[model samples]
Target: MFQRALICTDFTDSMYRLAQFVPSLAGGGFKSLVFFHNVSVESGREIPREDPELLEKPRQRLQALLREVPSNIDVTIDVQMGRASESILRLAKQHQSDVIFLGTPTRTMLEEKLFGSTTARLAEKTGTPLMILRPQLVSTYTTAELELRCNHLFRYLLVPYDGSDGGKTLIKKIHHQVKTNPNSVLERVRLLWVIDENVRRELLGDNPMEQAQQELDKLQSELAALNLVVNTTIVEGSPIEEILKTAEMHDVGAIAACSRSIGGILKWSAPSLTREILRGSWHPVLFFPN
Candidate 1:
């Protein structure tokens, strides 16, 4: 459900390879695409120097890739020298991009703690939605696989909801986008609520299962009004396991979620369900900042 996209990549991430299939991406309803890369300023220099030759290489490479895109679509390459996250946010605003595409590799906990993640940093600074793709998975896709990937990027979404504030925010954002974008690819959504079985059992008379079903039913009606087909299910199990399992069981393009809070670096370091999903999901994740 995105028209304009700003895709950032370090030459190594393989996400830049998307430039080779711009026409396939257009099939997903993206009208404009900007392939961006930021070259970090060299160390030991008081002022960063811009080397035209160094910049020209990537620029030319990107241009050659764009040649494969359909002529009817708008496409460009952006190569700059600066901090990666700052440059990305700046470009997204300049382009008025609807989504920012990023490739994240699997990282050990130690690596994330020490090196920090650019994706995590950008999420804190920008309001644009992020489409996080796993490099290991995407880099291996065949041409036919890539075409299917693009065509269904936003056709359907699997949302993990718990009737919490974060869940409400996620629902509101989806409603807003559906109302605003007539060409949105979001035709269907599946709402899942997983009850944590580890919690202390309560002796209260209230039936938790029935309560959860009622809540989901009410939400389904609200979302259905936007001309979206909404389906929901409630299950008792480990939150992460069930969420991931349900995502694969359904015909969803992405798992939509939001962070519980904006704790900056701490948020990235701490254990989070949303972060866990982002890291573990083989399916693409559409992440919204808290």
Candidate 2:
């Protein structure tokens, strides 16, 4: 669903490894790629000053990773000393990026609140989509494996569709994306709806399963109209667990999700399916923020 991409990496997260795979990323459909890194300003000094030298090493390291740039692809490197979130937002805008890539390790909600998460914060702040990878997974992938992964990153997406307004909005956005980019690398989409037998059984009334199938079939047609191969699933079980299980079974590249809006997401209490997926999924997540 993205073409112009802003890839942000903290060396520790292993996201910079993508710099070596520009050709693979291009194969995944990104035409313009900007790799960004932010160096935190050193503190504790009576008079703090930004150091130009701090940015040079990161720039060189990223540059060193690129062997050959494709003639059809535009690639750039940006390194600066600043707050990561602010710099990422600025660079994303400057690059006109449709997506920003980051690596976020799984952490407890308590840990997330105490330590903070740049990925989560960015979701709340930017309209640009985020592709979040697990640091542990990225750290372990062999170069060959990573390259293959980059090539198919958006080819197949596993989307959880609850048929809520937010779910409808997410589908609409996906349609818009594919409609605008006739050559969008996104070829197949799997829509999943897991009925919570415990909670939603009442809301869905006597024929929840029938109702879900009808909704999914409608969504399938909307996506299939774009010539996308669309598949739909409806099961009665835990939403998050079923979604993850289906994603793995289908070998999906990413789990595509969206919040109604940043403000609406901020108001969601604990144990939201979206939040749980964001926190627990080892697979890459494509998050479309409002």
Highest-lDDT candidate? 2
Q: Clash number for model 2?
A: 0
TM-score of 2: 0.95
Q: For candidate 2, lDDT tens digit of each residue in 147-171?
A: 9999999999998998787788788
Q: Residue-wise lDDT of candidate 1 within 160-231, one digit each (tens)?
A: 998789899999888887888877878899999988787666832268788889999999999999899999
| TM-score of candidate 1 relative to the true fold | 0.93
Which ranges of candidate 1 are over 4 A from the true structure?
42-47, 203-205
Q: Summing lDDT over every window of 10 consecutive residues in candidate 2, give the lowest-scoring window.
A: 41-50
TM-score of each: 0.93, 0.95
Name the lDDT value of residue 175 in candidate 1: 86
- C-alpha lDDT values of all predictions: 0.84, 0.87
- Give candidate 2's whole-model lDDT: 0.87
